[model samples]
Target: MNSSRRAQAIAPFHVMDILARARALEAQGRDIIHLEIGEPDFPTPAPVARAAIEAIENGELHYTPALGLPQLREAIAGFYRKRYGVEVPAARIAVTTGASGALLLALGALLDAGDEILMADPGYPCNRHFASFIDARPVAIPVGPDTAFQLTAQLVERHWTENTKAVLLASPSNPTGTLARDEEIRGIAAWCAKRGATLIVDEIYHGLVYEAPPQTALAQAEEIVVINSFSKYFHMTGWRLGWLAAPAGLLGGIERLAQNLFLAPPTPAQFAALAAFSEETAAILEARRQELKARRDFLLPALRELGFGLSVAPQGAFYLYADVSRFSGDSFVFAERLLEQAGVAITPGVDFGAVAPQRHVRFAYTRPLPVLQEAVARIRRFLAERRA
Candidate 1:
């Protein structure tokens, strides 16, 4: 039997293929410097790990309420109150199975068959796929350095159609590491409100911003849905825990979706995440964020020196979306050759979207400073040899 049409329509996440190839090369004795995946290199903080161990030992493995444990939800709300100075009530929070689960619940709650959702091209690919899963149309608006590779209220207005039902966005977005300005977020939220359309903002990279403090979209508008994960800033990628804060009106529907789709998020993970907001964990996460910022500072100029066109400097996140047109017309081929010949693994832009993707590639500065330096050096030699 054939798979469903929706399953067939989902495009493969090409970075995973790049990662698998990189791993194979490593197994065959090649020194692979991974700049592809967007996961942090740091381990989960001590306090968070200890909490998980304690929970496991105490037999705290029973299923929690589908919406999540009451304490964990309150902790997430407290994070918003303390971190972003926004008061999100615990009742509005739903601890999800990673941001992916939150995205599914949000889309499932908002979209119906034949609806349309607007988002930026070269955005996180899964946003579109999530819409597709619901039989909704995903309209990708092309964005570039002109708008910091982000969506704006004006762009949303320009792209609005009779069938449009929602808008999805990410600050400190993957593949680009660019953030939408706070004012821009407010504008977009207002626009969506005026139209009675839903707006979902991915804030998984919230605490990882450099140059200035990060702002939550919830601060822009109380009605907006905010999705966050412990995976990024907390260095807990493997834990598969995330959460979403929705308006009080939407929480009931989201809870129903969460109940049916997820049953509940992992019990041990929920317990462990309680410590994610602790002061001790905060210090460790802050140090890792600084380390990531330094890597970005180094890789940005190094890649530019090697002839990659990086028009916008990323202010946060651990990725640099570089235009590789000068070196190679096709980013996928460039990435493959770089991996095979130079032992450096990066994601091709095609993985993000179809907006001039052939000319772009993404570098995730998730590796250490010295490892990034070595990747840069290898690319330098590879380019020189190709020129000769």
Candidate 2:
């Protein structure tokens, strides 16, 4: 019995492996403070929870239409109109099991086997794997400090190949937490349009921005495929609900794939997510957003005081992708030591991409303030002792 070669080519999620290792240590009495995972520490808001409860009570837990409930689709479209002022019709939206599902649908619908899809280095690793799963080549365009670890139109032009069928990127990206500029996004859209390439934007971190709001590719072109989720800002990770807004013409192919691949996204999650858009949930989440902002403020200076050099002040996402080469070039070892000695868990950059894996580590500030403060204190002590 043999597994598919494609399955062998992809690696397991490195960050999650470390998280599991840390948890195992904790079971043996090590008090670990987790700053590794990207998930928010908050739970789903009360209104959203209540919506799920009502749906279950009303016996609405049955499987829905393959595309999803019409009301939920309409509500998602209205959300875009109100939130980003982007006019998207319900017919163009496909609710997915998660942003991961949306990515698979987009890749399966858009690319052929051996077709190339350009993505920035240090991007979310799953984007690359999703391409691999479909027998498509995920071409890594090395975007370094010069590009702020983001994909630009110039880089796209430099790397564009005849086989390149699409471009994928995340604003307020996963490992880097760097948000691509609106002008940069517009330029990429124009460049892709001219070359007949599809533009896929992952805006999952749109609402978690600090200092300024993140830009949506939908504002640049109506035909682009935009993937968003209720997981991040809405604190609904476990519910497993997300959506993809693609061109009206692409909807048919996407729907066909969804019908076969997923049947439909979870029914209760879709119904529950409606409340995530309500004014009441918005007010509740705004306070959580501000709390994340404060944690960012607190952690930035603390990390610097501990001598962690950061490339830039992350403007969105609750992460600090710090340069840890000053102390050691091996981030995996550094992360291990931080967890074992300091009782603090952080993610190694190798999980993101191979650009400069040994030199970087990412810390998520999505935990409670007290927990983050204690982790900072422990890290500071670890640094001081090493210096002494």
Candidate 3:
């Protein structure tokens, strides 16, 4: 009745909007300590930056093939081989503007209008937007702490329907930061295989995990879509570079979609991203990962000590999604109060889903240890005052 049904069906990302507001407030002289946005606070690795500069000076800055520069695709493919021990051909990889572009491309390639795609609730909100953008239904599978806030094989099986064409999942998930087990991934893949449903895995946070590295979805299914980015692990969010590795068959559709949608990833970013696979860069990023792990270690225990309950122990990513219902039932109100009263900004879990949304908040521990420690101290003071 009012505009396209698609537009009305989706919700805007509230946490990002709140983060923007908090940033604006900081710009107006408020000392808002940002734990809201999920961005790493590190500069890009020097080698990666140097590569982009060289490419710009050398004029390798023209539009590339839609499937991305062959060399970059080869590099991404090699990344899979070296990191995952999976033999992925360069032909199966497409460099997109970022993981965002990859999500759009994947949804366009796989979904038809009015089709249904299953994704875990309390998951990445953008997945729902992507599905809605393409006129597909994003069926939220209500996942909670009982399953580590993940979409398990049993849940997938229970939710499958005639219109369900795909299952989209993120490992080391965005809000909760919990990685799905390998066996769980395999089971979901096998279940999807039988039902002709596609499985999409978001591995953007793969390199940031504190525990052992996650088993990629590619290891389980030949037909799944895998997305990764240089934003999180490589500290290159502004670079806007990421890649998607799909089954050999899906390459044609994705390439065509990417060609028309993005033309190609940024020429300079792609060139720089090649160096992202270098040994020196790898070592540098590993060091950064260790630093993030340290920040997480500091923030996690401190939050618990200050009386915040965690839905799941985050084994990876730079986020700690804590249950703050004891302090304030409304996460948005609590986050706002934290920003205004305590100078600490955080993301409300309500942005992720409606299930117990008001009870949680996500704190990004990607900043330096001192920053996180200060934020924790401020939060403790705020909670202590509230209790009094």
Candidate 4:
């Protein structure tokens, strides 16, 4: 028997392999400084944790509707109204296993086999895979620092083909951490509307913006499908809970797909996430967001001083997509050597996409200030030794 071609076609998420290698070295007593994964180092907020504990004690573990607990959906809707001043009805929200689930559902609902979804190169890898899982062509248009590592309305038009059916965007994108301008988002939405295509924006890192107030794509257009999660902003990665807001026209299909695919998101997690929008949880998350900003501030200069080429200071999320061409021509080899020689782990650019990937790497500032300081010091030493 042979594995299915679809299964074989998916490339490995290289960072996981890097993480495993880092762990192996740690087991042998090496001191490893991890700057690889995008996960926040903060614990889940006290209110959320308490809610989960209370739900468990109260035996609120039974499956709710496949779309999610009605109250939780209402809470998410209220969050949009209060935070972004955008009105999102609870009926349009579908909670899922995580942002991953939301992506799967959105792609599943929107894409047909042989259809095409346009996305940026150097984007979150799983997105491309999601399109592939359903036999859709994921067209990756290469973008660079000139556009702040984002896709613009012009780029979309230039790349559009007869097969293109949707456009997927990630503001405060995973590897680069750069956000699309609000006007550009509006422009893209307008273009999609003109072309009679769907627009899906991944707002998973919505709450972590630094340079400006966080804006929801829902503010730009209600028809836009917005994907969000408890993982990044709420510090609940392990809980595996997320939600998507679909326009009324897409909600029925999304709900039907959610019912068939997920049955329901984790019951206890939904109960716990109810507290995620509370004032108490907001304060905790705001403090952590500031801490993340501080980490980015600290590490950006430190890495530049160590001779890594970081042209753009990321405006959101906890990553710095760096040009490592001065140090090495290939990012994968550079990452491996850095891990083995410096005991520091960071993700290589190959994990993102194939546009000048050899010249780039992503540094996640998901560590404490002191740890990042140490990683910088080690990288400095590594560079000096390699030069000598």
User: At residue 14, what lDDT does model 2 achieve?
Assistant: 76
Candidate 1 minimal-lDDT segment of 10 residues: 206-215
Pairs in steric clash, model 4: none
Off by more than 4 A, model 2: none
Cα-lDDT of candidate 2: 0.89
Q: In candidate 2, what residue range of length 10 has the lowest lDDT sum? A: 210-219
Q: 1 or 3: which has the higher TM-score?
A: 1
**lDDT by residue for model 1 over 45-85, one digit each (tens)?**
99999999999999999999999999999999899899889
On a 0 to 100 scale, what is the lDDT of residue 166 in model 3?
Answer: 92
Residue pairs in collision within model 1: none
Candidate with more favorable, higher TM-score: 1 or 2 = 1
User: What tens-digit string does per-residue lDDT give for candidate 3 at 1-388?
Assistant: 5877767777877777777878788788887788877898899999999999999999999999998899999998888899999989999889998999999999999999989999988888889999889889999988888999899999988988899899998999989999888888888888887888888999999988898787778998888899999899988999998889988888899988888888888999999999999999999999998898888888888899888998579999888888987888798899888888898988998888877889988888867888888888888888888889
Comparison by lDDT, 1 against 3, better one: 1
Report the lDDT tens digits of candidate 2 across residue range 134-171.
Answer: 98999998877677789999988889889999999898
* Model 4 regions lying over 4 Å from their true place: none
**Model 3, TM vs. native:** 0.96
Candidate 4 global TM-score: 0.99
Candidate 3, overall lDDT? Answer: 0.88
Worst 10 residues of 3 by lDDT: 1-10
